[model samples]
Target: MFEQFFPNGMLHYLAGGLLIGAGVSFIFLMTGLVSGTSTFFSSAWSYFSTLPFFRQKSFLESRQWRLAFALGLALGGFAFLLTLGNGQAASTGVQWWRLLAGGALAGFGARMAGGCTSGHGICGLSSLQLPSLAAVITFLTTAIITAHAVQLAGVLP
Candidate 1:
């Protein structure tokens, strides 16, 4: 009964969600910050480091935690992929150029929209902010359209 209910790794997703919620709540309680990953990364980007967009004094001040969280996230994903052993299974098998283009588009979209999906979708939506709702809706709609378009173009397997 329990296995069926949690079959095909449902429990892992629940655990991941619990971990994300706890981490966000902890960061908010400790720093009074919104725990936005895109914001943190923007604060540390080498090219953007000298740019005004990322040079706010307060953003520079809390560099320690932001770097820690960013590195931790990257490390965690790498470790998880190693543990999974079949990480290639997650690939869409699209050409590398197409993947790079998609990533660039996503980055541009995130910047233009003020924040990335996790910022708006997870944190903002959880706080019941209308802006977050709008961002999430837009993100999902674009994602759906993109996916279908790629499939229709015979680019997706």
Candidate 2:
């Protein structure tokens, strides 16, 4: 007894989307901050750690709230995977170095784009910005091309 149009737990996707929307909206409402994890994470190093990167400004300030927000995002994701996902997801069969390389490339891409998926796809789109629209389109197109290329190259399962 399942829905014809929504087979294989389609409701779960809807629920997840609603939760994301609510969470982002709540963050903006309560803190007047966009729920952009990438920026928060990049800025988080200043609060609990010190680095020469601060030389440009020669300043030290606190952004503990950003740290908390980033933590909450991580915890929420882990919780979801642990609970609803039964702590299981498909493996990419990639080695640690490969994963690190992928992450580095993604970070580079985000930097060039001035934001990550969360900033562009979620918050910026919600604000109905044309730049966000373009960014999202580029992100999706790149993802699709990369996925197909990887599959064709037999690099992933």
Candidate 3:
């Protein structure tokens, strides 16, 4: 039964996962930077808030730069997803509202938590930071509880 759904994409999944892990590790290793989704959001926030002439900046004023950056990131992420052969799992026919709501919640949580899953999960854990380990444990616990609660409530499909 699971054969039809899973097929034989184990190698692709392994390779894609390895590529992402290696890429993020290499980025941290080389630049001492964390390559995670939070970084992009943080950069966006900083660009809009910290700059004295943020409003005067072309990217901030028109948002064209932000749009272009998002497009590029989407395309690049799509390429990465496609290479994984798990693209079928990407589309769940979910509505945009659900995603937006989730994104907003996550954004707020990341801010309140002082960092995001990527910041703490990938970079922090890789660096063997105790806080990151705690963060990861808390994140997983929250996810499990929320998922089970949502499923039990039948609020989501």
Candidate 4:
């Protein structure tokens, strides 16, 4: 029983989670920026937008760099899909539409909530802010309820 559950394993996950927490804590301590997923995506979007040449450059113009970047993102996405597919065998599975919808929802939610989960939960908690604590509690509580509701509605089955 222990071997079955621990095959891919728990130690690595615990270590990785600790490292990520430490890194997020360090980021808050040093830069005061939230180590949230939305913040990272926003920063990446900003960086990519500033690089106009990346958009203008054709595949032939910057063949190697373009190919490498595209391949890297594709492989990363593919791996994520594979993991999700394996873990949630009964689900409808990954879809591009779901990605787009999720992105839009996250962007809207981040704006409305005043901060994304990372900004409020990790950074805000690290900074010992009362508002962030409240936000995190509300966010998590709502998430749990919403997840349950969705499952009950057969939206995620």
Q: What's the lDDT for residue 93 in model 4?
A: 69
Question: Which 10 consecutive positions of candidate 1 have the poorest summed lDDT?
Answer: 85-94
Clashes of each: 0, 0, 0, 0
* Of candidates 2 and 1, the better by TM-score: 2
Task: Report how far off residue 96 is in candidate 3 (Å).
Answer: 3.7
Evaluated at residue 113, the lDDT of candidate 3 is 73
In lDDT terms, which candidate is top? 1
**Residue-by-residue lDDT tens digits, candidate 2, 28-102:** 889787766665545655655667663224123325566777789878988878998798863566767658986
Indicate the TM-score of model 4. Answer: 0.53
Residue 55 alpha-carbon offset, candidate 2, angstroms: 6.1
Against the true structure, candidate 4 has what lDDT? 0.62
Q: lDDT order of candidates, best first?
A: 1, 2, 3, 4
Candidates in order: C-alpha RMSD to true structure: 4.0, 4.0, 6.1, 9.1
What pairs collide in candidate 2? none
TM-score: model 3 vs. ground truth: 0.66
**Candidate 4 residue-pair clash tally:** 0
RMSD over all Cα atoms, model 2? 4.0
**Cα-based TM-score, every candidate:** 0.76, 0.77, 0.66, 0.53
CA lDDT of each candidate?
Answer: 0.78, 0.75, 0.67, 0.62
**Better structure of 3 and 4 per lDDT:** 3
Q: How many residue pairs of model 3 clash at the backbone? A: 0
Across residues 4-26, which tens digit of lDDT does each residue of candidate 4 receive? Answer: 97889888678766866886666
